[model samples]
Target chain A: MKKLLTLTAVGAMLAAPTFADTLRLGAATAQTGGLAPYDAPVMEGIHIAIDEINAAGGIGGTTKIELIEKDVRSDAAQTSIAVQELVDTGVSALILPCDADPSLAAIGIVSSAEIPAISTCASSPTLPMIGGDYMFANFPGDNVQATVSAAWAQEQGHDTAYIIYSPDSQYTTMPLYFAEVFEKMGGKVLGQDTHSIGQQDFSAIATRIAALPEQPDVIMTSSYEPDFPSMLKALRSAGVTSQMIGSDGIDSPTTFSLGDAGEGVVFTTAGYAEEGSPLEAFNKKYMDATGSESQTVFNAVGYDLIKVIEAAVLAADGSTDPKALRDAIANLENVQGATSAITYKGTDGMPVRQVSLIRVKDAGREFLGSPSPDAALIPAPRMQ
Target chain B: MDIFLQQTVNALALGGTYALLALGLAVVFSIMGLINFAHGELMTIAGYVLMYCGIAGLSFVIAVPLALLASVVAAVLMERIAFRPVRNGSGATMLVTSFAVAMILQVLFQNLISTRSQPVLLPAMLSDSVHIMGMVIGVNKLAAIIATVVMLVFLDWFMKHQKTGIAMRAAAEDFAVARLMGIRANTVIAGAFALSGLLAGVAAVLWVSQRASVDPLMGFMPVLKAFIAAILGGLGSLRGAVAGGFLLGFIEIYLSAFLPPEMQEFREPIGLGIVVLVLLFRPNGLIPSATLKAEKV
Candidate 1:
């Protein structure tokens, strides 16, 4: 009777669809709070891509991609809870928040369930290293981005640089990478200072920079909006006229919206919307879908994440099985995306994608060509 | 000498804002025995008003008054709608109620305005710096110091001379006796919230000047610091709140200026540790109130 019952259950399963008609992708990204500026755009890009893909032919030309999203509210504890809730719903893959600390919060659940997870735009290489094989960061590594900035600064003849870094999170520690590569390129680090996140007053930091006998040729930091604007205003107000170099954290309307205060600041990001490039096309779609022009590279980063998943599904020959998907994604090579051709194969889970150098010119982003730094100069990921 | 002068100005500017906020919290807590965590929301209310006024292209002259008024009105309504029903409950109940009010206000701000920080444009002169004796000082920082001093003076007169102010003070000293002495509990409590809201508004303007933007959670940090300042001084003692605010500001700025670069990240912990040491020495805070001392005895 038991054998017959098992055979009947197997027969019923075979009678159902041969493969899942829909693939559930769970996202626990910040819709509100501090991380919203980055995660919101990325989510919009993801939405646009999912809509375009499902409308065209769905992933692997059959299974529709279904997004099950929860706002983590930029809270780490909430990230874990949201991830667990999504996992309980049997999601095949997870899209975590855009910061390393919050994304790290969801790793245990996703890794234990063998479900693959990807951060929207966390540049920290530590995500993959710490989250193990099943976790991936869908953006360029911090070391890679920082190296690009340092190389660009060298090319611009910036011989001495001062750094203001926040030791608060892995995301804010990009200055260390920049400092390492800058020194490797024979540039002198004039000074390095620290600011806590949510620190509104930058007068002390600015005063220190201004008090230097000979001002450095450039200043670098990884501060984001709210803090970034105040920092720039304080530095400029304090008469520190050095060229400012920032990481992708400053890629927000708030930065450009500073008008004259933000003028001539350069930052490194995941992609440049080069004319006629895939990123440019995505920007067009984004404007139509959201009725606002894409302001940051994060929109492209979000578009790439969906493209990556679709490519993996097709590469796995239309299997939605978690392990099969993870293996296929780990082996994906040169999958052309909105940002650049992403290759996860043989690179652990951190993609060596193109890094766009952007200038805050005339209150808007000016795309400088994606320049690949000398690989040897790129610093190793800081484990801490 | 130049660096000393500059940081002193910075410390004063920061302390002034914290003092106003701490005084605001202390005002309500002294009268009601309820730590109004939602006092931050009053500041947030003022900030959002500034944002809206900026959007409407209103000049700062008009915007400032409108923003202050908005905060005062919001505070009155907040008490009427939320606190009145729970007024007769335990202190813990009112404390939880204030937290709920804060959370609800934050959610409303997120949904109604934006989850993102909205830029609040002030007069461009606010960003300008003045040079005096080889030292540069921000015009906004000076404004904050002046504003705080002016408010403090006015508050001093109001508390000492006004009839309603005396009533509120008497109520804070002993609510039951003040009620028997003909001070209406409702009127005095409402007056306290209004005064608290006004103080929060002034602090918010100083804060908003520095950031030039406002988000739903913008008030969280300032209020948290102010709460600490209030406790460090003595929760119900107005003078203690002011002293605590200045002390916190001085400690923070001096540490930032003097601490080695490698130890800069430890500034917060060290600041709190210093506060703990001070508290250990003076368990009743720097200036415990007579009523509080009597209750302790």
Candidate 2:
């Protein structure tokens, strides 16, 4: 009887860890706050990726992905605690949305744990430089978009550009970088105005922009979608006729609903649901599966992020070891994706990929084309 | 000079929105002595109602009234369900309950209406602008200012002339004494919440028109601003709340204009700094009421 009891205890101990082989994926995002617009789609994308990967035989052939989602509620401090909770649950990797400061705060925890964390939409230049090798961003940093936007404006013969940026971290840096490039390219910056993130009235700034010796040929604003419509509306109401240009943050259906006020407003972005290209195929799959259109680029990146992780796992010869998978992901090159040519260069080099410049034309964003490397005439010091 | 005038006009327009928000918040604070943390959420609920009505094919004219009535009903129900249960409880209990109510409403809105940003469509007239004194003013701004002035006048008249309103003021002054005077304490508290809802509804219309969008979290900033405005004006003084709202609005815009472009983002901080200065000079706020006494319980 004693020998039989010993054997049973041993068997139970052996079986427990096999059951624990399930791969845990953590998602820490702004589930309920101002950033919900960006975070919700990213969450949807993560779930879709998990479902697809699990269906196609998950990591190590047996390990299934289990998602543990936590709401950071748009507070940077709360994100640290959320990440810690995920770490406690033995999350192998984390998927985050486009939050710059919060991501920076959680980087140390993720790095120390040696877990690979990929942010679906955070494109701040500072991210790559500060996060070292452990962090990866699915999209090109804001500087790349800023460089392309300045070149596009100059290509359209806009010599005088009025730039407005939110003093909030992510949006501010993008326009500031673009201004640096636009100035380097011999285009005069008429006036550089800064606004607080949630300021409803843009009249003072609009009045100043309008009173310039010569009204700017183009006004470039780097701000999120919620504030962009009001800023544009105020600018137009104040009789400032300068053509408005915005960054990737403005690419949403909400922009079109701004009605004629958003007409002639040009912005640079990567994905649009209306385009029936191969890119739209992925979007269509997402829509068909979820019964909702993938309206933003973050959703595509979310899908691509899971695919990249899957590819990395396969490339590592079925190694579920975190370090080996991390190395494989860092060494990713020439990987074709629905949105762009993704190449995950290690901490030392930039990720060389093709980024598209899209414009909102006639109430929907249309793909302009791939940004020509040589066509980008401006040289701004890369901050990241 | 034109820019200066334009900025001042902008300040006045913003002030109108702040004043209405402060009025709504102050009404609840004065009568119930319960800081309705959910006050802004109530406004958001009104905005959502309007959005839903519009989606259901109701015209803006009909939608606005329906939204306002819904908001009033919501506020009254909240008083009955959430606030009334904790009426005689500790302040901490009341505060936590209000926060709980806010979270519940926020989650409900997220699941039901939308978790993403949605534009608040405006009528064409509200979107039009008229140039006055070299400053551009939208019809929306003019309407907001007119609405605020009329509401303030009507509120003053109600408090001074109406029996229920006088009883509410008496209750706010001393609840025990007012109870002895045959005032129904529950009715007075409910009326205060209803009034708050009415003001919130009007403010929601003005605020949504400015952003042209409404989200579940839209109430957050406005609520914080109104709280600060009420404290700046005097916690229990309705007139003081109005004064503080306009004061905060002017200071924020003035700082935005005078400060360097890079520093314009510090406008809120500057406004708060002024508040600190005011508190240091006048601890009871700009306009204090003699009847406003600290509660022992």
Candidate 3:
């Protein structure tokens, strides 16, 4: 009987899994280039999320999630290379931040590998339309944010508004969404202007806005931080002080540093860390680890992505098969996370969560409660 | 009318920054026969130095000069370590070396400083706006323009009359012949880099004062503009580079101001279009130097 027991124990030891049994996860993020600002916060989120999972005994009881990072260097070609390398390394799923164009460039490669891919931040509607079942975004697309922001402005009694946006794919589409919603809500867009990214001086645009016969009650802009401040400075210098509103891109520390010029500039964004939210705990963890505030939406997304992956892994019930893991992620319904309750309803539906609208006051951001659904349009009587 | 005048003043201020940047590029290109792509990185380095000094409790006045001095030292070192060895090498080799140095500097900056953009603080007076003729103007921009003009004038005098400057010019004109005249090739090249870095340092001050922020890649736009300006003004001519800088600045600003809002983003491209037109008409740039005649042929 002792000899039989010893043989059984040796057989059990031989069946035990090694590091090769762990599931590999790859992140192809903007490690360089223009999008680095957004990418950095997302990476931080990924690290925090992954750490939380590992601490909780990891996935499937036996297989831990192993993270491998590759800097796409913010190039489309590099993104493809990074994704292929990660897939080649046998990662079960690939994660990326919210850059629409570059993310699109990597889709063919990702799909060809038969590996599940999710963009934690890429909110462009084009992604889902293109990748079908293979692609998912953790956040709402630009249209949703734009719709919500315009609705909020109308609720605030902003009837006459000036719209300024870049013609670039990301920024241009956002303000167009706002304009469509605002006009439908009876708001008269007094003027529509366009500027290119990286064009510093906005004197001409400012002058045009100032010269309008009917001055806009609010000025809405869609651009990133670099040009946003300069635009605001030019407007302020010209004494054109229509209340300014920006898209999610305005949620940057650099926006506030525009000094008095950036005062009262409000914008919309996904919730970062609100009081009594799970993210508050995550924020504390981030601060402790990174020694800096997780200020952007990317931070929260980063934190939550790890949770989503871990949840999917646990729900798989000790299965390390890639196909099983992919199905597990797709079936994630109402998983409560620090950022939001993430649910995947396949490729055809929106994530069933509300978007947050934030405001800049005294050079700091404040979450102004979740916008009302009707906030996308002002009441019809006030539109005139 | 007031707005137009204000726009012109804005153009002039922008032109000043451009002139300084172009002058730096021209100095290095003329002496070394290679464009120092790292020239913009030199500006970024100096800006960071000023930022460090300011954080260390030095006044902007003291910090600015110290930063400029540091830039000179860095430029001299770069010449000695990176450029000097490759001096007699092919133009492509020197160009590639400069690009390598720029990449190294960019990575160093991103690792050491927070890659996230940070605001560059300036003294209160530099940020304040002044009104003239019913138009608003930034006092700092005005100061930048004046400083640029003064530096240009000083540089012109030095290049024309100073013995060292004359020898450097001689080297630029004919390096082989200048060596025969007992002009040390290393001295002229080192001086050129020093002067280039000095101008870059000053330009950084003006640039950071206006933008109020600094990042690792902040050098990119300015450097590209400087390269274009150097070419537009005549590559081998220092005065022409300064002229090209101001001219490019004015053209960019004016185009942005006068064009429709939809076309404002195209201002730089429009300015470049004009430069192309000038090149097509003149072939050797707007102010071709006599020394570059053989090269053009």
Candidate 4:
């Protein structure tokens, strides 16, 4: 009787649609907090991709994609809870917000569950090293951006530089990588300083730069948005006439508030154009649906992640199994994205891509250089 | 010689900002036995007020007092609406209530504006620096030092001779006794919040001036620094708060200025040494209270 019952169950399973199940993606990001502005766009991007796939008769012809989101509120403890709940509900993969704070909080739990996860904007090159094989960062690797930033600075005839780095690893890594690249290219690092994140007063740091015996040709930094403007204003107001260069951290409208203080500041960040590519169409769709302008490059990254995931799933021959998806995503190469062409190196498992060189001029961002294929690639780590 | 002079100005400006914020927090704690964690939100509201005024193209001189008035009004309302109801509650309850108010204000600000820090345009003249004695000092920084010193002196005089001020001091020392002595708790608390708000507004201008931006959580760091100073100076001691604030800022700025490039990252750890020093030799804080000094500060 037991054999007959098992045979009957198998028969019923066979009668259902072949390879049919909802491909569940868990998003553990802040819904309300400092990171919400970043998180909302990524979630929308994922939804946009899922809707596109599902509209065309779903993945594998019958399986639809469902998103499970828990508002971690940028809280670490809440992130753990959200991760546990998402795993218990059986999500195939997990996605994190762009910034490092809360997203790094959730990646560990997902790794332990043997589930695959990708970060939208956490740029630490060291993430994949510690994140196990199950985790990947979708944003351009920090090392890649730093190298390009150095090359761009050199191209602009900057032979000497000073740096003020953010205290956090995710932020300071850019300046760190830039230092590596700078020294490699025979540039002198006149001076370097580190400031704690959220430090509003840059007068002391500014005075240090001002008091230098000979001002460097360029001043570089790795700080994001709010801190970026404060640091720039202080340095500029302190009579340090040296030009400034920085990472994507300086790509904030807030930097423009200080008028001439922000003038001539150069930086590197993600890019997207809406002229001739599918990104243009997608941008229109996104704006129409969300009723809000895209806040930063993370919006494009969010849109790109969904497309990349779709490609990876297809590369796995339409399998939503975590191990299969993880392998496929790790090996994803030359996946055309809205921001740029993204390719994950099999050696380190981080996406390598190009960034736009932007110059700050009178409260506006003007493109200084276009994407360079040679400059954008992340150099593989050498075995010492 | 020039470098030394410039760094001194840097330290002085930084200290003045810290001292003002510390005094703001200390004012409420001294009178009400409340830490007033939501004190920072007063600054945030003020920034928003200035931002809207700037949007209306109001001159910087006109915006300053308007921002101050808005901050004071917000702080008074906070005391009336949030604190007055929980005025007699346990310490933990009052703290939690303050946190709740802070969270509410934060969310409201976020919904009304973007979570991202919005730029606050100041008068271009604010950025102008005066180079005297071969060193440049930002005008805003110079103004900050003057404002802080003036406010502290005025506060000292008011605390020493004014009727409401003495009642506040009496309430801080012994609330029950002060009430028995015909002091109305309501008037004293409102007055304390008003003064606290005014100081926070001054600190806000200094902060917004430096950052050129404002966001809902912009007040967070200033408030934290203020709390640290208040504790380091001796909780509930106004003079101690001022002394601790300046000392904290000086240590932080000088460490950054003097530390070698290789060791500059240790700036924060070195600055935090004040907390250790306080905990060790002077747990009551580095300065004695006004009452202990036998002279009103």
DockQ of each: 0.55, 0.62, 0.42, 0.63
Provide the lDDT at A136 for model 4. 82
Q: What order do you get sorting by DockQ, best first?
A: 4, 2, 1, 3
Better of 2 and 3 by DockQ: 2
Candidate order (lDDT): 1, 4, 2, 3
Residue pairs clashing in model 2 are none
- Give the per-residue Cα lDDT of candidate 1 at A120: 92
- Distance (Å) between predicted and true CA of A321, model 2? 1.5
**First chain TM-score for all predictions:** 0.94, 0.88, 0.88, 0.88
| Ranking of predictions according to TM-score | 1, 2, 4, 3
**Candidate 1 positional error at B144, Å:** 1.5
Fnat for model 4 comes to 0.70
Query: After superposition, which runs of candidate 4 have C-alpha atoms over 4 Å from their true positions?
Result: A1-21, A48-63, A99-108, A277-282, A345-347, A373-384, B160-163, B290-297
Q: What is the lDDT for A191 in model 3?
A: 68
Please name the candidate that would achieve the greatest lDDT relative to the true structure: 1
Query: What's the distance in Å from true for residue B142, model 3?
Result: 2.0
Candidate 2 on A52-110: residue-level lDDT in tens? Answer: 76886675566567788999887788888898777765665777656677877788888
Query: Compared with the true structure, what per-residue lDDT tens digits does model 3 show for residues A1-384?
Result: 756755643443345323234667889988666677778788888888777666666654456667889888778888888988776666777886567778878889877876777776776666656765666667766666777777788889989888888766564446667777888988988867777766555656665666567889888877775677777766776668788878766667677655666668887766756677877887888898889877666787777777777777677775544566667777888878776787775534235345777777787777777653553342211110
Best by the TM-score measure: 1
User: Candidate 3 on B26-80: residue-level lDDT in tens?
Assistant: 8888777799999988888888887777567789889899889988888889899
lDDT tens per residue, model 4, A153-255: 7777889988788666565647767777787787988878888888878888888888789998888788865677778777877988888888765556666
Of the true interface contacts, each candidate retains a share of: 0.40, 0.61, 0.21, 0.70
Model 2, residue B138: distance off in Å is: 1.5
lDDT of 4 at A126: 68
What candidate 2 gets wrong by more than 4 Å, as runs, is A1-24, A59-64, A88-90, A273-276, A346-353, A373-384, B293-297
